[model samples]
Target: MECTGEQFCSIIMDNMVEECVMVSILEPMGVVTKKVKGTFEQIGSPQQYSLCDHHQKSLVYCHRTMELKAVTIQGGNNRRARFNLSRYSNASTTTTNQALPVVLGIDQWNLSCSKQTDSATPVLQLERCKDQLTTIGAQEKTVRFLFYKNTTGFSLTTFESAMYPGWFISTSLEPSQPIQMCQKQDARKLINFMVKH
Candidate 1:
């Protein structure tokens, strides 16, 4: 499942004109309330955070409807993924809600949805999958990503498709569609973003 706008809050960087998906980390005391703000272009920039000292053992979170939700990817014959909205919480308001399920859209580069249908679920076709994400109308292949945190905060650092290298993860114009991997020179600059709350 691609991390598009369906589950994530997409923010466009003013200066660089790049859009990044907002991902959060689950903290023990409560969800980390600090907001991560920075541009991927400036790798040397400092991040402002208000997180706890123990920032370990955290899970990936997706921001939806101003609330932070937990993300889970299913295993086994059914490669389904969902976000637990029941655990939804508002860091600023300090409010919690009942847990609900949001189905993930497995269209290689698209985000997940709340619909409970098979067509809504994306199928990962390894052999038929495209060699690059940028190539649309390719086979369906779900991808795993690698995130890096340098001097910057916990934003997306760098990512590669499951079977495709030299091609990195990226988003296209329509947020409803799957994100693509491009070979263009600026593709890296477009995807190597910081993930913050």
Candidate 2:
């Protein structure tokens, strides 16, 4: 099915406790990476997005921290010879001014939280260089996941972290356990959603 870039999306986990993904808000501003049942509204025009919930609360949009750059080696023995290296370089990373994701009526509006202050948010960033969506900072070793077509069926899609390719996003009943990357020999993480929209 084709999306018009304005449809609400539900990121459902195949084996999560709540069976939905949510932008959880906790004290000190914490984002729940674990999957929970949630109704996410897709915001932003064109292809860019800022997710919103049923209560009109928009999810935090974590901007790109560092950008990849190709730097050429200086002082080469041969004038015609040059070496190239791809690396992450610090850049101007900022977040949107929209209010962070809140459960509405539960937590009051918070204005103190800011990306500049290093507060946590529910927005996950997709790093184009490595082709991974990172929940944490855009560090190389941070918790990063990859989106790909389902192995069994080409039409469906799923998320799998590069660190743990064998495991897919899953959830547990316990709050301590929450949702996590789980490994199942016969399981497939494939699901349908408008990733671009």
Candidate 3:
């Protein structure tokens, strides 16, 4: 998982680009008017994290997707090595939607999913975004996923696709298979992972 998007985040020298504090005024109609103001994001940084399988096998980028491999210190610049972990937040709009959904970033590509692939099944995808988000709440919807944290006080985590709910990010029991999106009801498949900082 080589990090290719060097321009992913511009190193900011001032607080101006990192955050903006201001006032807001709005009037929907002559009968209703209101004023509101607070802080807003102009750009957000992707915080780093590392992901591994339940067996602690590091995920490596391969064939435009992910596969299992031994954790390596030389994770980046190797092309197929696991590298460049980041938390790419999902857009927060509708109140009913999960708050701040997450899209895990492997290298620069997002850990995305599609309802159907050439095999006509849900699968994981490494999608490169054409338009980088300039705000915190703006996200690529197709890449969004919901995080399921372990309740027993472990750093373990699992991800389920936001677009197609109940489909989780999973890998085959057999080694070397590309990661796939498995149904929640599926009795087989490895979905839980160890997410580390």
The candidate that achieves the highest lDDT relative to the unseen native structure: 3
> lDDT-based ranking, best first?
3, 1, 2
Better of 2 and 3 by lDDT: 3
lDDT by residue for model 1 (1-197), tens: 57677445543333355569888842211111222122112122222221111111112223233221122323431222221111111122211232111111222322211113555322222122233322122123222211111122443333322223333434333222333344325422233433322
Q: Between 2 and 3, whose TM-score is larger?
A: 3
Candidate 3 lDDT, 1-197, residue by residue in tens: 53345533332333235567877622111110111112113324666656666765566666533443434334453433443433333223232232234546655566666655456566566667664533333244433432222211255456665555566677666665667777745655666677665
Model 2 lDDT per residue over 106-190, tens place:
0111111112236332222323333222122333333232211122222222333322333433323222122223444323311
Candidate 1, lDDT over the whole model = 0.26
Return the lDDT, model 1, position 9. 53
Winner on lDDT (1 vs 2):
1
Q: Alpha-carbon error at 179 in model 1, in Å?
A: 1.9
The whole-model lDDT of each prediction reads: 0.26, 0.24, 0.48
lDDT of 2: 0.24
- Residue runs of model 1 more than 4 Å from their true location after superposition: 1-156, 173-178, 184-189
How much RMSD separates candidate 2 from the native structure? 23.9
